[model samples]
Target: MPIVSLPVIWIIFIDIIAWTFFHLFISAICMRLPLAFFLKDRLLFQVFSWEKSGELWQRLFRVKTWKGFLIDGTIFLKKGYSKKGLHGTRLNDLKIFAAETKRAELTHWLSILPAPLFFLWNPLWAGWVMILYAFLFNLPIIIVQRYNRGRIAAITA
Candidate 1:
């Protein structure tokens, strides 16, 4: 049987908007507050840290090929701006990149919340697709954040 049903697709559409908007709001709050600083010390952050995902294949994914054109194209994540806001030493960049990575990782974790909420509607394929899209959109950014953060951490350490 098909994973998604036609009747539930509309609910899935709304779920997608909610997923994105929720993260955007969370991102804004993170920018204003020191959530990243707090999360840095939390046990939860450890699971999402760079060390867990760092590997030969992960490095290969972050390479500046076609994938970079899509994820890093964002104005904020543009080029090396994420690590160095145009001017900063590698160690200083680590501090900045650390915070960025924390926020992205947090946002990625929160992205899955809406999927189960929508599952109450019927546990259809549409909800699953939204969850999958959330992963697709967030995972690359998360990988990039962790990849660069690892480099930054090395320089600072």
Candidate 2:
């Protein structure tokens, strides 16, 4: 089969690069706020906010609980468990926090793809390309979430 035109390939590459950069910029802006605030305000819990799920998992695992989502952030739970009993200072809590933070970071990074750009043009190929890229980028997270759920189930069992 004949190869795609150089211009078309260049456009695709530009789209990918532009989308990636856009996501990175957006994430940088959003990360400024406390992630828990975002999780609470965004109704992220309904979506099974990684943070919430992680907190649940840590409680299941009997790990220490910490505050903030990122490793670079402050760790608040060093003493008695919080009044709510959900609070505890443990390494597992910290791990869950870090993992959820990374998941959020990854989601933000992937959001840069200009999903609307495909709609701007009527070309069938453009739509196909965007769909393929979206599936490719999202598959990993889907798999990981499934795997984590399974792990949680096993631990609970």
Best by TM-score: 1
Clashing pairs in 2: 64-89, 64-90, 65-88, 65-90
TM-score of each: 0.65, 0.45
Q: Tens digit of lDDT per residue, candidate 2, span 39-147?
A: 3323232325443544554555433433222132122323211222223346555434433444443453456355645544425677666667766555444334333
Q: Candidate 2 lDDT (Cα, whole model)?
A: 0.44
lDDT at position 144, candidate 1: 63
Compared with the true structure, what per-residue lDDT tens digits does model 1 show for residues 1-157?
3444446567557665776677666555555556447336456544345364454325677333433454432244222224323235655545765666666666666665655555555455655776677677777766666665555555555
Q: For each candidate, C-alpha RMSD in Å?
A: 5.2, 10.8
Q: What is candidate 1's TM-score against the reference?
A: 0.65
- Which runs in model 2 stand beyond 4 Å of their true positions? 1-6, 38-43, 47-113, 119-122, 142-157
